[model samples]
Target: MRTAAPYASDPSRVRGRLFAEDESAFRSPFQRDRDRIIHASAFRRLKHKTQVFVEHEGDSFRTRLTHTIEVAQVARTIAGVLGLNGELTEAVALAHDLGHTPFGHTGEDALEALMQPYGGFDHNAQALKIVTSLERHYAEWDGLNLTWECLEGIAKHNGPVTGALPFALAEYSARHDLELHTHASAEAQVAALSDDIAYNNHDLHDGLRAGLFSDDDICVLPIVGAAYEQVDRLYPGLEAKRRRHEALRRVFGVMVEDVIDTSRGLLEGLGSVEEVRGLGAPCVQFSPALWGDLKVIRKFLFTQMYRAPSVVEMRKQVTAVVEGLFPLYMERPDLLPTEWAKDVDAATTDIARARLVADYIAGMTDRFALAQAEVLL
Candidate 1:
């Protein structure tokens, strides 16, 4: 790894973990944080979780695990170019989607609606819950007991939390004071934007593969259209699959390069990591032109892919599964697994029991959730 920039997060200057331990002799703190995240149960569950498609929907679609890896790749590249802590960026990227529910955003949306009276669902906040209080593998602690910086990055990855927070986030922030009002470190910001680049580009690929749209459909869009045009100029006789791959790779590259160039221009006078955080805006971002173009592409995707009839049908099915399971589990906490049953039994209030029910449902894999719905509903 190259030396980090002055504005980069320094593991040596860490705010320390919630439960302190002796520093590792070989690995940096951020590297250890990355390793812990990789070994986490929630991280492993991502393999069976959804990005845009459910896990059982197709073999080729990107799961939360694959999407996180893609985001990490983009984040590390941008972080390396900008002289930020690549390991920290990679760690944040890897852990960013850990709290996602079973059926992608659809499951989350359904759960959020059901929990509206109980403070609602937010995956970012759920991620904080997973890292801080849910993962119980550690002998010394319930959660991963990650470094303060890692927690901060994860909490503020989407920028500041100025308004009222979700229940999970508010509870955790009350305990650890993640400084939710300030922007995260540049590394976290890199991880956040890398998520955008990965999902936007990969969704295009997945949508094309799923027959949600076509080359003709995307070729009329902004950034994607330009990428296809470039690929045609370079490889005129390319086959459809290769042509799609080639064009999309160029789209990914353009987005990555835009962030690097734009961020470099933005970081000209920033001298310290604190300065970067205090700016109250991201230091890692695409240029205004590309950002505008990406918004157009995103709008196109929302209309043609996300809201398509086939996808909406699947979403409705999965949403039914989620909504059914939450109330069933809440009504019969004995249906919960042994470990979760203990938590449910200890709950003294309706809201507490509801949260436990949410946690159980939130942690389920897609197949598991569907199976549970069938048996219990």
Candidate 2:
């Protein structure tokens, strides 16, 4: 049977203010953003960046690039199953971490502290700034002219809509019911959850490979062990090279099936087309019972993997690199990309200066940021 759903319109095809081109045989707006981001210097740098551990440690472990790919795959799987826009979900998944700092969250934290007074250094907001006004690709403008839908996805990737919107957007609340304090589209929600599912499960696997933790340690964490047991039952000897890939794949397949089952039931309850599209139900999350299981899994990973003394030690080095770089760059903006000079001068105060510094740093990819830090040091 055909899906009783509207055809997913590409956000790129959505009319925008500044992207009106006369002679271009262009793609949709979201597609344009995806392609532009793929071509950008920053997106390419994800290859050298850390997802959990730094990239240079091992070839098998996930880098930012690989992690993004996994998230996109997981997200696309969920979106396609749920009749959401798979391409839009993939686009958001690809661009979701575009503004993550060099060493992942550690670098983001350092930059956030350094730029807190300057409207804060959030990865989501920086991503918005990058697509809207920061990154310099074309001589015509400072950044990529992404569509509002893509911008909205980036801004609200993992946060509450109330907190995610810019101060100005706070006023235009009603026109965007989706923009207001409401649930994100099923696509964005799927991407967000996929990010959590991908990182939490994979990070544990990586931690074990690094010898920072062991499977026994992970299995000790309440229901997480059970989940692993399920994996074992589904694909035993997952530690074996051949089974490891299959094991992970089964986990994703299982989780995605859960999401689809839940979402379809929820969608059935919506009475009309307007309600279905305009007011996204909050039923997109993992069901509470399943989430309870996931929580136990997350807690075990957090204590045994993320906060392990060994990981902290490595993160300290990353923190130092970002912290060291922020001050030096702020003190001498000339070190940044040439585009920042005008923004710096237009700044009326130190707050403005700090914001400009953030613009410079946030635009950097993992490798470029590290290289620049080394040059400054």
Candidate 3:
């Protein structure tokens, strides 16, 4: 591997895991963290979790697992160009969405609404919970016991948390301070932007495939229209599918190159990871012009795909599933799975029992949640 940049996260200087264990003989800490994430039960569940379309809706739509893989690919490329630790970036990207509920944002919104009287739900906080206190695999600890940098990156990758943190995040922060008010490592920032690149581009592709929008519609948009123009100039009368793929690939290239160029210019004088954290803003980002263009693209997507009639209908169905399940499990704790039933029974307060219910529901895959709803509700 290439030497990491001076401002990149250094494994040797790691803050160590929440529960100490012997280092691996063959793997670096970040690599081990990546492997642990890949092997986790939650990671495996992502295969059936929602990205946009419900997992059962179509075979071709991007599920959470595929989206995570795409994000990791983009993140590793950015990290390599910046001479940062690819493994750390990959770990953060891979583990970032492990906390998303059954149906995508729809399920999360429903759960958050139900839990509003409780501490409420945040996927980022739920992700931290999965890595820190859930995922009971190790005899020595509860969660994955990941390195502190990995945890910090996972918690603050979108930048510092200044306002009131969600319950799970506040609970973990009380135990180990993640320095919630500062930026994470540059690699984390790369992973965060990589997420942006993957979702924006892939959503456009998926939206087209789902027949929510058409090529003619997207061909008038800013970055996307330019890509189509370039593709037509190069390959006149190309097959429609091939033409779309080639054009979008160019769009993806533009985003990746913009991030590398923009971040390279930003990191010139940065000498240490601490300096990276203290910069008060992300060092890795698209150029101002590209960012503005991306906003236009996002607005287009919000209207054309995310809020399309078909998608909105599915969202309502899934929201009902989550909303229906939460109360059933809450009022009848015995309805929970065997292991979860034990926790529900032992809970001393309504909030404690509600949190346990959230954990059970949040861990469910789309089909499983639907099946449970069919039987229980």
Give the candidate number with the greatest lDDT: 3
The C-alpha lDDT values of all candidates are: 0.90, 0.68, 0.93
- Candidate 3 residues 97-191, lDDT tens each? 99999999999999999999999999999999999988998888899999989999899867898899999999999999999999999988999
* lDDT (10s digit) by residue, model 1, range 253-306: 999999999999888789898999899778888899999999999999999999
58 Cα displacement, candidate 3 (Å): 0.5
All predictions: root-mean-square deviation over Cα?
0.9, 3.7, 0.8
Order of candidates by TM-score, top first?
A: 3, 1, 2
Rank the candidate models, highest lDDT first: 3, 1, 2
Model 3 collision count: 0
Q: What is the TM-score of each candidate against the true structure?
A: 0.98, 0.85, 0.99
Total colliding residue pairs, candidate 2: 5
Q: Candidate 2: where is the Cα deviation over 4 Å?
A: 1-4, 7-18, 22-26, 163-180, 220-239, 269-281, 341-346
